[model samples]
Target: MADPVAITAPTTVLIKVIHCIVGIMTAPLPHPTGLAYHRMGHCTGRHRWWRPLLGTLLFLGAYLVLSLVLFALSYGVGAAAGLRELPDGGHDFGPLANTALDLTSIAIALPLILLAVWWPGRRPPGTLSSVDGRLRWRWLARCLLAAVLPVAVLAVTAALLPDSGSDSGEFGAWVGWRSFLTSLAVLAVLVPVQAAAEEYVFRGWLTQAVGAFVRSPWFAVLPQAPLFAAAHGWGTTWGFLGLLVFGVVAGWLTIRTGGLEAAVALHVLNNLLGFGVAAAVVDGLSSDETAADSPWQLALADVATTLLYAALVLWLARRHQPRRLASPVASSPAPAPAPATTGRTVGHHGESGQDR
Candidate 1:
């Protein structure tokens, strides 16, 4: 797994470009290849010596290239159809995409995971090693601490805040129960894939790579936190914070527990529950008779929710003070003793002097 063999800069760039093109054209959604490549690029010192700076640059380039390609495709289709102007109403297409992205990620991610799992080695790194296989009780507690506390804090804050000028209003109604059920089924099927991708990136890949370089827990845990956060983009500050903090906690737990299973379990459960809550809230509050309006307000609420959620997650992590898992000590080698020296007797001027 350690690809220490030097990859020439030109080769890396060429591979990256090919990867971006293949990944984009093949998948309906952008492949997580960009993410995987970036992470590998950083770990391998291909990306500006441990900084993901070049990796980020590569990702952005890939993203831009992919976006342009998609735009061209759409434009071509639109032109052939004789459509001069785009639709005025939005077609957010969440339900439509639900199946493709989920299925694609799983279909792509699983084979790679299996390959990594089956590969023979002196020791499998991350939580995959036999010694680290045992699950810990405290991880479940941390999962609970992560999922519940943040939502509770956000709910309270939303309750207290005056319904200001905002736009939770334009939020559309849920798809039919059937559509929702289908989405749920797709999610259930894909949760493992999504969770595995995250765990592989954060706990499996980055944590081990970071652990190899840094002796201290902070150094190992700190770097991946922001990466996790930034991956969420400006989705919501609080949510971003929550995931980043959760990333740190999970990384620490993996370092301690020696397995990514617990982290994956917690992540899937958290996401499923969060999605369920949001769906339920949307359905329960909105009706044809009482439809609301406000875009800016919803945006504000999102920001607030992300911030509040992040704060709560960090607070919980602080309260728990989970340390890195205990690693077994290795046997020490004994020190070698100093070698003995014998001096040959020096000959004197005469035989009598030598005898005396």
Candidate 2:
């Protein structure tokens, strides 16, 4: 039998990085018993009014750098493929190509967001996911399972709805199986990362940092919703409103559950199901088209579905004991007390004597 090799220092660091990544992916759903967002803010150390500003700047700076690198790489690929420029002087990577590239860029940028949280928040990276700074994998898995039904219902409802004249082409453009499968493969690998990245940035890092400054979870959660919606650039009032509602609900879940896991699960499942269905059924996956301007009935249906999902998650969370936030000191076991030592031991006759 070969002797076991010692773990090298580099190997240890790599393992930790992998662990943190996994934690980010598996943040649990919100539960009443979970730590409150306000309390979680306290875990990030002393609150500073300016910390959130700094954190935001750090995130944007890191993301910008990643975006530039991704764009350069994408341009090189288009150039290599001899892709021609559009009449507007922009290169047209086909729909599937564009979707895959966008997802890839998001996946690559996620780690930088984590880095921003770690650097400006001045806390260990895992705290961005939960109050305890560790992901509850089992809890996260449960939330993901809970998310499927609502997301599926929403996707199917959207599919069945009559398309408005606007962006009608988005629904009918079907790439061949080869392209579809390729896009599926990319989405399967990167969508979760992309979704989790958004949750970490808006629901996790921003919420906590802002919560710390304001000392109230509501202030932390509500204020970021518009910013979240703006980030989408949905290009329509209704689309913007929908995204704003989505962000607000996600923020509420984060506060109620005392962590980002529930919100992450909801976001991940929704994107995965939505994108997967689009790739399978739609003509072009890259273009954004939704029934945002549909009749009040359809919009109401969408809102109802979202509410149902949130209710189910909250109900399930009620059934289970909410996980208490683990204290940092408690997470680390105390060193075994050193054996009491004496310079000299009293002999049987009471004479001081050293033990051999």
Q: Name the top lDDT candidate.
A: 2
Cα error, residue 140 of model 2, in Å, equals 1.4
The sequence of per-residue lDDT tens digits that candidate 1 reaches over residues 259-320 is 55446655666555444444443342222111012233433553454445445445654666
Residue-level error in angstroms, candidate 1, position 299? 13
lDDT of 2 by residue, 49-110 (tens): 67567877877887888888778877777788889765534356976677766777666656
Question: On a 0 to 1 TM-score scale, where does candidate 2 land against the true structure?
Answer: 0.77
**Deviation in angstroms for 142 in model 2?**
1.3
Candidate 2 ranges beyond 4 A from true positions: 1-35, 38-41, 44-48, 86-90, 173-176, 290-298, 324-356
* Local distance difference test values of all predictions, in order: 0.46, 0.69
Give the Å shift of residue 176 in candidate 2.
4.7
Worst 10 residues of 1 by lDDT: 285-294
